[model samples]
Target: VSQWLKMKGKDPSIVPLLHPPSKEKENVSQLTLEPIYSSFNDWATQFFEEKANGYLACKLCPPSSRTVYGPKTNPSNRSSHVIDKHNLEPPPYLRNRKRVREVKKQKQQTLAETPIFATTEREKQRENIVIVYATNLLSASTLDDPLWRATFGEKLAGMYPQLLKEMTIEYSKNLDKVFFSRAFGPCCLMADGGKDISKHKLLGSCIKANGKIHVHELFNTENEVLDTTWYQKYFSRVITDIESRSNLVVVGITTDNEKSVVAGLKKVVKTNDHLIRIACGPHTMELFLDDLAKNYKPLSEAIKQARNFCVYVRNHKQPLSALKKYQVDVNGNPVKNPLTLVLSNNTRKWSGGFLMISRILRLRSECERLLRNFPDVPRLSWSSLEDARDYLFEFYLQEQILQRDSSNLIHYAFCWRQMGRHKDSIVESLKATNHDTNVLAISQCFVKHQEKMEACRVFDLCCLLWPVPPKTNNHSYFVNATAQLHYLVLRQWKFYQDHADALQLPEEYRGTNENLRLTFLNKAKGQLTMHYEAVELEWRDPQHLFQASQEITEGHLRQTLQPTPNLSVPGISVEDYWRSVACLCPELRFVVRILLACSASEACVERIFSDEGNIHDKIHNRLDPAYSESQVKIKGNFLVERERKLREKDFGFEELEWEEE
Candidate 1:
């Protein structure tokens, strides 16, 4: 070939190397000797150069096997096969470039059969951005501005309504899943009413049994007062509607102590005995604080002085800024105040009295100095401040304790016990401050709280059943516990029996007699016994948990009485701890699940009211009340669902111990 090229007057170097077909077959073994390309550029150039002769190679593939792939020209197809078949990350640039080319090619084909105005990829992406931005900020109309068109183009900017509709539909579907799924099932109902920016009445319900916001609706009462009758009928209707839609029973309803709401709740309970009626524990505590303050002269005088002092600072920004500056100067932290006075207001959820007292006590020295610095500041008598803190410190702490995780069921039994202790503390205070006018008022409120706590036999029963900080499973404890459990079961039985009698169901199915009561009690005791045993055994040997024998009760009792903290227990949450130990005590799983679903207070619903104010603020004021409801519901439930997903991913639901024979 070189001799022929020389005779033709062309340089021999210009001639392309051409291997004979027979020689190519001989050289196939040598072709497999090339090293694997580290990147796309090397692989693409080398492969295509070789492909000029209609050959394909895969250096990474075993040479003993077919180390070659295809005469594949499509980079995407080649990269995809390499990744799938060889389990490798294909080069990014080549894969992305190939993907973009394929997409454009498909787009061209699509455009050929469509109108010229068909939305392009860039327009679709811009439309998606606008939709997401609008949905997040609740600012749908912002996209309608002419300024947005310059950046997003008219076609994309104009699609905001469609984008919003799609988002609403997606959000609705998610909410539907939350409502219908067992994961969000059988929740406590927390409902409250608040006005929006336009003073439009909004009533929202948060189902905390499964830690998901199930319903948040706006009531179009149209400038009318929501009286007792309205609340009664509305609550019943809402509960029924939610139950029907979600297929999840409302275990209980919690509300603040408005006389109308209290009376309305009574009506709800009258119709549904299965539904427990609970006054918001936090709200009740707030009332207790108010009653104490009213009855106690010194405390009332102290609060009056504190309120005036706060008013002077708050209404005057200069004084407030001076106070903050004093806090920073004294503490050596300019950016953060050691403590900023939180003005106590009647409307605050955690009573303003508690906040005022807590802050005053914490920063008593600084506050006194600040008062002196600002001569205009109201002089709170030192005796008044000291006397009020002395009298109200216990009450403040109790209120704070009850308010803790008010939306969590795990703390309900604990809160109930704490309330009893608080009553005792109040009684002690009543005696200590015998001359104070507030003593009688505090005593009266304490008596009422004591009676309420005492009436709920189930609260005591739940306390007996709680797993952590183990109880002595003694003969006396068991006997008393059994009696309490029996009382609760019988009450539940009577409730169901009355319902059956009222409905007059088929005679065979309606049999709710002493036998049914006995059966329930027996099951309850058995489950409790097994649960106690399982919890004890779990600490000893979790691996062989199911093998734990009930006959080893005495040994289990001793262990439970003196639970040793291991490396795992401290980090584990109450839910996770129960979830872990539940398998060993399988019969008690459902009982624990129910207890966990209960909320101590209706704070979750109250949180929605605050959220609604933010969502329907001036910038987002045009949001329809219904739309606002949807947004808040999705926001709250999405957070809970996300946590649930992460928990499930880490420690799955499949670990639940099922009931054994």
Candidate 2:
């Protein structure tokens, strides 16, 4: 190759020998061996990353990739197959005049000289002129808005830096985003007297599109009235800004169960037609505890004790720390939160925030001890605790969670033996009628809360007059009217002739059937009518659920009778069937005549739950996932001294024993 290159007026010394060629005569014999790696133009290139016919055809790998030919390939195998030593493809370029001579000459000369560092006078002047022009055009006042404070924390402190100094920088970072602030639609405001959540205190509203929940957190002040006013101003401003930028509308407002938030939204919307007001169902449910307590004082008192017991276990961690003090189960886990000792799943809320019955029993021993020592610690009285427990026992058995058995008959019997929650619910509703402030709204809530068959007669007539004349009734097809008519039929058919005048079931429908066959058949026809109607619900609807379950039960019973022997059709034992129906549907008892020869057990009903829904469960089974919280240890390793020094009050986390590696 060297001789050939020199003949063509190229560099005589072109190819580099991998090892320095020996000058000794004896080394000439070693040159007889084939090179594992070859070279060109003294350049050290990877043998595996070059293109030439001596290598295999490239697969999916880049074209630059190279390999010696063969199926069994390895790092040590660098041989080109024996047949292809001469039959090869040409490379991209040869060790020639264009590559070696000219390129090498330029590279050597360039490396020998020093690099220039200074810019030309014209270039320097051009950059400085650009900077000066931009400086004069820009205004420093642009930094005054919340935008600057959002991006640059300390450098651009907000107007009220002292007030916001305590809040986290990340919380206020929303102001930095221009895209989010502009070209937006659909903003809703929500406010409540904020409570501290572990590390931070927050006041915010949800402004969103479709289903995206964007939190617009605003600053809050200590002065309660001023705090509310600030939120209102912020909410109103954002709404107006959004409306101007885009054709946006305020659809709904959801607030916590607080009086202040309700009062704030009340200012903007009057009848809830434009701005739909929704309260957190969980919060409204919490208020039920207060109502239940007033109606059945005994149950509330006990629940208080149970809550104190759970809190005490947390406060006095030392007592629960040792394994020997409280024996571990066979699984080596400690007994669950002692709250279960007082509050059973029966009447307990799903979140298990606090229950009256369990609190009483769970706190019994603790209360006695507190009385013996520091009597000043407040707790429920013994008489109140007993009443609370007795009342809650009934609620627990009545609730699907606590009574796991399908035997609503048995569950109801057992629960009723204790006390009925329906009684408390009704009593609470009746008491609201006396309140003059929300006299109308409260009355509406009252009727809905404790619904009864006979009570629904008023709403039936009200439905007839719903759209008066010009507007059509909500009932769309014959199916919808048939559905409503069935409701009317079942109700009218069941009512005693004596009660007919009081109910006023429209004028033509007033007369009672003198013939027993027609009356019974008409009543059966209403039951037999297959009709469907859709209801517009704000959120959760339990009434629909009850109706659905009852429908399925009655349908299945009638279908089962179709194949019976001796009789033309199969039929349920009327007494038992009606009694069982009454047991499940509290509203049906008035017309159904649910008196059973013997009260039915709830076991069948519970088994039926697996088919219908998960409405039946044992006391412990009914407890919400939150109650199981104290059961598991948190995941991930601890962070050394940081986790160790973290006080109990700083965050509601249990202290860990080890540091993360």
Candidate 3:
């Protein structure tokens, strides 16, 4: 404790002297035998009189013991000296405690006389009120509500401009810092057009990098409908601006598969082979389903009949009442299986058709009953309804799975492969239901797109880089996939071999021979192949038959291929499992990290469009486009910064502990 106090620059040694000795008397003797003085003023004014040199004659001090104490201009100072040195206490009128109390009372009285405007607490209160009022005004927040008006005062209602000006200046400074920061990775830029409340089309671009939305900017499109050339120029400028500001490399761009958008992206990708262009996955899938619904005769007729039936029930009163009547329990309470066709629209999500079909099928018996009662109503064919359900059941389930967000890098590979399986299952089910190939032809169109999606080079690599082995988990196809990956790697090696003179070398190998470069490539390829074969062999030889003599024995391979019992056991995801065994495939880990950062869909940017605030309402139509853009950018970047800081703190602490150990 004493050392701590000394470190704090405190005089720990003087603690004992702070409390004086108890031997000293508590009350001192009165110094004078004169009559009791009324007050210090009365005593000085009556007998001694003040001197010219700011001193007062102390006649009482001389009579008691001491030489005259000259300073009486300040009565307290004189009394303290008399009490401490001369062993004398002051009279009641001149007591130090009473004087202090009177001074405090006077201060309180002065404060009571002051106005509320001059006080610091009231100033702060008013400032807060103005800020809230201004925010409500600028954001088009409901100000007329009695509840809001009662909450924040009616005063300072027009303070929005002042607050907004100050905020804009401060926000600009912060945005500059964010733009210049080199924290983000190579980004995927996504742009799509949306409409404001006034039906004005707004072209918005959002940059997604490092698993966060880094920026979202909106531009008023005016009268120019986005054409192929317009989009090409706009996207190029967007990329250059983002790269210049954030130091981000533009890796990929994603948009819906609109005709104009597809053409625009084609133009951008023509000369930029290093950059990727992705047709928004969910949108592509939605379009495929839309086409299937239109072209497939049985499904089309079934859906049309269902829609007509639903419309008749909704528009006519008798059928609607009957549906409610039929949907009741034994105790007379209404059941909630009320049915509607919910006809799919173009803007509906990918799963909209499936949901609609499922609901119609669920109410099939009820619909049949309703149809029997209405003689004039056209009937829905049972075969058509059954066929449509059978064809769509597997697809509906598959779409549900695909629409979910996958957290792991390996899931991209896993999901696409599962999609292939779902397509096959749908075909087999269709074959069993019908002998004809008419339905099969329609399904193959979607299957072709799925195949194209799986052909993405990075996706193929991710599949090959999956940490586990094939045979034990029933993945024979991966063997061929691995060979294809090896072939791709060899092609790159051959290219580098041919262009050894033109190749940029690492710092350590800048002056090395061409043979050394080939040797390095050969060595790396050998290690990768060895690791691949060892994992495959261990999976095939589950009994450990080849354990004794091999360079990477079956036992070592088993340890690598099998998940750790406590660490990679059940309930752990594939991504987390691969992360745990990252040491096993150190070379693959880097590519996996980069591929994980790449989004498979434009869902992030679509979400940005859907996040329009009240500031975009018609009431606030005159609001500056720059203000809207900055607001979104700040909101998104602030969230990203918060998550990044938290993760850094958590992982950094864990890393420090691991290092110490």
Candidate 4:
């Protein structure tokens, strides 16, 4: 090949290309010459040459600063040295190479146009998966799981933070539209706090408006000391912010019987005269039970014995097994999943003390049989347990009634009166049984708490507006409550009337209509006075009240005071009743709406905290506090809307009775 190339007057280097070595020999030759060929090719060959020792020395570089590439060095090293040292343009082939960024852009565009990478449906699926993950408390890392990836595809995985942000914004907007509508009116603020499994102290707040409770804000108060001053300041700011954001007027605040919270609320009420502070009725009743257990020796001893018995059975496997084995029905058939003893914890609001006693009472036969083998267990005082159980059962019913979201001051008053009657009956029963000390102690406890509850003027006023006349025989108390009701109604009416009148007139004409407004106000007062007289008269006579329903006629006083059907039924809604009568008594309806909207207990806020605990559980302990709170708020508002929709869908018919008077 070299001899032929010489005859043709061409360089001998072309001889290798024209007559390449055989396949085996060519592989070896290419491997040996690859480094030399690559280093000298294109741009590098312009300014460098390979030496005997297999180094490519740069020609353009100064002698002292000459750069070289070893045999094992990459071709990029030679090319970089030539271009950088000489500041010369790269060869055509090198210059035409695609850049890293342009290559990446092309790949992305190609992928975007692919069928699998289509976004519309995939994006929706991803959004739904994120919502399910959030609402169901699924772990964010589950997105990366092998099974999840295989089922949902790899495209749906990751991006948790970004997806969560979008969902949070969307749910926040939904919550705003649902809970904070422009028709916002009077609402009560409820606040409570507790520690989650993570030991993070959380304070939750809720607003009750239009007979539904809406979660407002949740704060991580781990660093703040929970004291009267802190609560006062915190609640004050919350109230101010809420009022500023909407047309809602916070007419009252309800909270559990925490000393600092109560003291703080008192301070808030002092500053804001229109606001009333209500102690949670259920919490108060729990305290009442606490008092009874402390003051009554017999009841206290019985409860302690019952608690010890429960602990013994639960801790000792032998007794528990025996009790379960012996558990049977009245027909002597074996039962599956036998009842277990419920241990009472003081930290829990329900106390479960009554539940504990009740369980033991239920498994009495089984317990008695188990006691034969396990004599070391403490014996229960059956009579004393029965007495305590029966007494606490009444309070239990009252607590359940009061804890309802629909419960209001009127319900509180009725429960209070019912408890008073139950207490008296127990005292009389104890007197007949010759238990003098027990009777005296029970009487004192009832009177003390009763006085405390009645001290709040709002309770009495709400009771006076109860659809059914209060069953008290104390005519003097009734007279005083009636007077207070009239005064409160008139005051609220004036405020509402003045606000309405001002809004109706222009700013320039408001001052000039003062005389005309006074005249209108006087006429309205006369009508309100007549309605008050009719309400009071009907309240004193139940027969007359029901009879007046039959005499309804236009422009008649009976029409104004017509008794609503099923008004005394326990299931009847006070808010609904007042709404039914709104046309007949707008002033009365206005006052009742505000009072009824004031929650009687902080159960709704307690429920919010419970949900937060579930969301921020051990598995999700590392969740961001703000994220967890948003989840709880969104979940709660969704439930509220769902319940409202359900209530709207529920319809019923009732038979109406009329009397020919």
Candidate 5:
């Protein structure tokens, strides 16, 4: 006890008093102990019962347990033992003691400091309100409206007009800090141009990083000529800026296949050998739909008549009322919500045309009844409308699938393959019906765009990487794919070798000796062949045993398959499949990352342009370019972060076999 007191920085001389000498204890008789015993008796009685033998037993413990205290024992000692051994609270009378009160006061103070009950900080609440306004495309002046003040009070109402702009600027700076802190990998650039409601020509650019698309920039291009030369210089400047700012490697550029844009990308590709130019898949499909509407005489006439009928129904109330009445029965009960005639927007792609045709077809019977009373209404061509709807329906579905931000080269190739099958079926049916002209037109249109899409060598390489076998029976296609894969692997390997010291290449990857280099190259080739065979086998009959031409054993395949149990399963995405198999295919993993990261469509940029239109509408026409850009950045990045967190929550984190250097 003396040593413990000394170690605790206390006076050791006081230790002897803790266990008083017997002479001092004897001096304290029953008369002196009586007062102390009497004072604790009341408090102790609540938890302990006194027996006839002058011993106290605890009531809380089990009856069989040996817990008894003698009468001569100090009441303080008995109380301390009971409280410490059983983890019990002090008696009610002891609650007012000074020490207990001090402890309770300390606890109250700590609870007061916790943030659980605290309100949001004023500045944070302000920023959140600004984000909500920007994301919903609300006018900045709405912040100061009377309704806002009544709902949120004066402090949070943001009465100042410039508050939105100021808050957006601050948020954008924070986003820049976050973006610059991460190590960038291979990414693609998507750029497009559009006009706002006020006729302000705007160009938007976005970058796909780590499979998430982020808006990079949006600015007015009214001052500059949007020619091929201008576009080339603009792309060069953008690429240089992106590379200078981060480690992102621009592997490809995707844009709509407008004449100027295509010519500009071609020039950019010629100068930058590493970059590939891709035509937007959704845009190409849209053009095909437009062709059907324009070139086919019967379809064109039906669309014209359908559009005229919609305009008439919307303008004249009598026919509209009649249509609504037809929507109900004699009892005037509505089975469903009354759907009005929908007008097609020239700007939007397949949706407008498809919706217009479908609505007209659904209301065909009602319209035929109304025509007897209203002769001015256009005559119905039910057969022509049905054909147009059927043709446009396929492209509409394709457009919806291709416009997804997650859609990569693999999805592009797969969707087009499905479209080709659809076209073939349509052609066969048309042949049976003796509609030779329609058959020829559909075949030629599909082949023309498909050939253009396949012109980019990256598509073929991605298709090869895809687990499913290519749709073609041609052996030459696979041969070319193998050759291209070899070239890509060798190129990546040489790059690693060149930067071996900087990359801190692992022993397996660093081919320092000539023989080591040759061996690695041979192994890469063998692995590629084995992968191709495995893919074919899985596609044809998953249960079939795969036999590699080289020394690869069943154990090796098992090891590769162990990590990716779903690799052979349908509905797995290309990005997921490549990531799962990355560790087993080290050399090809680098190529996969670079090639798969290249987007086949500029749909992301087009969507951003649509958002821009909403932001720059007539009500918010005076929004400055910087303010608009900041709003777009905040809205885009905010949504991306939200979606990422949701994905992580829904399907835990995906294990990546290799991370980019």
Candidate 6:
């Protein structure tokens, strides 16, 4: 710019003298924080690497004919490259030699054995025929070692087309028969629903409880009928084929909060049994976010405007010109987004793509009366407004208090208590935002809550529901200590009400009615509610419940043993169990594991997910080549080490021998 000034008839020396080269005439313009990069090539290269640009990349690929191959070789019946490149692959008959090799081996074996054992050729034939007819026809294929290389093999079979074509078709037809049978096989194959981690999409019935969380299978109602509902009606028949398993009825389900599965299941469970439903913790968290905007109206407006500021400023001249002239400050870090995406000005740290946008909104607001011009923007999340308000109101207090507490127990106790609302806020916000950051934050914030809640529920539910022999005695605290307690209390009450006449009944029934239990529960609850309320648990953290409950009096079994891990399985390490379960239940494992691992009982699962938000859709393609995930239904974390172990294992379980776990 200084050299240009010298060439253009102005004093070039003036450029160095000015602290900044550009400023508005009114002296009211915002200072440009962006640093100018010396290398446009490096800048542009780094700029396009972010995942957000991925969608746009697909649009840039207009079709072309592979840039045209080469001079047309003498036109031949077979592709020249196949003939030239893959001669060793054999013609169709020879390729099928492996298929027929077993028969040839049998014939060869019979000839050898027949000469030694038979008196005559005809006698040898009868002996061989007798053994051969009884022998099982077999080729080496297995459930564990299914041949998937056929996909690549078919592509390689182009050589000797006339000789191989018919054989290739026969091979394919045989493979197809195997494939169709597998796909149509008993749907004992239950893949995760891609959203809900709480409920498996099978004949899962609610375990009776008063405040039991309703775990419901999620399904896409708009496009196709889901397995959840299909199994609901036909599960009885399906189970008959396997074993007759019973179903349980409860208040509702805990799912990702979609109405489709919830609604369908409600219809299936409908009867005089009395059932309704609700969304799971993650889904409910979503509700809170949208509600945030409606309640904290300002934050909603701010986020919407923040979003619009990015869109609006790129079209407006003032901001666009300023951005073009401005250099990004962080090593000219090749702007995290396209110039069009970041055209608006903002003064905040601008750490996030969204926050950067929000800052732009702020910058635009300062320049123009944006708030007054637009009262409501469509699709602006409500939680953004509520989150801003909570940060200023509630979270601010939490941050200050949490920072000052030096003693861990007191600090943790207070932090645990103080953090409940914030976690709730984050979970709600994340659910609303569908933003992994918010989800992760929620997981981290109130992980204790989930730990406590799930632990209490799991123990209570399993003990009460497990088809085990009833013990001579059980304690109130033991049953109630579990997550299932409150709901179990309710179910016990309902069971009495339905069967027991309140005033005049089987004397046995009257003793166990809701009125009788409520009276005792109200008194018991009165003694503890204040202390329990001292720190409400975080939903993301399931382990915290056990920890928090540890402060309470011990149960009979617990008095002798350490508190059981809140996780569903008992024989495995909590961490290891959850690590594997996360594959089967990624979202739930994400929430539960974070809670278990943290001292404060708030694992940052939501935060971690937020950090990984860009890869949510990319996870399948980005597999670590371990875990043998390709062509399989579920995949997980531990990718690199898993691949290393898989290669070492030589693609089979137990090193050439089969063993049951």
Among these predictions, the greatest TM-score belongs to 1
How accurate locally is residue 49 in candidate 4, as Cα lDDT from 0 to 100?
Answer: 76
Query: What does candidate 2's lDDT look like per residue over 505-568, in tens digits?
Result: 2443345333322343334333322221222121023333323333334344434323221212
Listed per model in order, the count of residue pairs whose N, CA or C atoms clash below 3 Å is 5, 32, 0, 0, 0, 50
Q: What stretches of model 3 exceed 4 Å from their correct place?
A: 1-182, 306-351, 363-382, 393-416, 422-440, 455-661
**Candidate 4: minimum summed lDDT over ten consecutive residues — where?**
134-143
| Predicted candidate 6 versus true structure: per-residue lDDT over 1-661, tens digit per residue | 5667878989865644565545554231343433443332222222222234232111112345111122332322123223344332334554465458768999867754443224677645433322211101010110010111111122222322222223224333443333333221111111113211222222222122211211122232234466556535543332232222222223323333445555555554454232222223222322433444444435445555555655555566655555443434457654444444333422221112234333343343232433344343223333463355344333332233212221112222333334454656655654664332434533542453444322222322222221111121322222222222223333333443443432123443345343444443343333322433333323213233323322322132223222233444333334333333322222232233223333111133333234343212221222322223332223234544454565666546574453222
Pick the winner on TM-score between candidates 1 and 2.
Answer: 1
Runs of candidate 2 exceeding 4 Å displacement: 1-189, 195-202, 227-234, 241-248, 271-273, 320-353, 359-386, 393-421, 424-661
Which sequence of candidate numbers ranks them by lDDT, best first? 4, 5, 1, 3, 2, 6
Kindly list the per-residue Cα lDDT of model 3 for residues 399-488, writing each as its tens digit.
343323222223333444455557767767666754334666667666656633433323223234432232223323232322222223
* TM, every model: 0.47, 0.33, 0.43, 0.45, 0.45, 0.29
Q: Model 1: what TM-score?
A: 0.47
lDDT of 5 by residue, 336-415 (tens): 65655334232144435555667766777777888888898767778878876665444534343323322233344445
| Residue 4 C-alpha lDDT in model 3 | 61
Stretches of model 4 off by over 4 angstroms after superposition: 1-178, 181-183, 312-327, 330-351, 373-376, 390-416, 428-441, 451-548, 551-661
1-661 in candidate 1: lDDT tens per residue? Answer: 5687899998876434443335446653343323446555455444322434566666555668634445656554555556667786556765676688789999867654442222677445543443222111111112112222222333432533233223334444444564465533344566655433444445545454332233334455666678889898988887887777765666567666779888988888777755656555445655666776777777777777767776676788877777676665545777453455455233233256555655666667777778777788888777767666666554435344432333232233335445555666756765766455655567787776543433232332333333222133321222222222222333444543554443233353235454444444444443543344234223223122212221223233233322221214333333333332332244434333332232201232123123343211211112222234444453345444543554555343443431110
Displacement of the residue 42 alpha carbon in candidate 2, Å: 64
- Candidate-wise lDDT, in order: 0.47, 0.35, 0.47, 0.51, 0.51, 0.33
Error of 3 at 96 (Å): 57
Question: Which lDDT tens digits does candidate 4 get at residues 50-169?
Answer: 888888888888899788788898877777666666677654444546255468899867654433312567546543453222111111111122222222232332333222223334
When 2 and 6 are scored with lDDT, the better candidate is 2
> What is the lDDT, from 0 to 100, of the residue 195 in candidate 4?
40
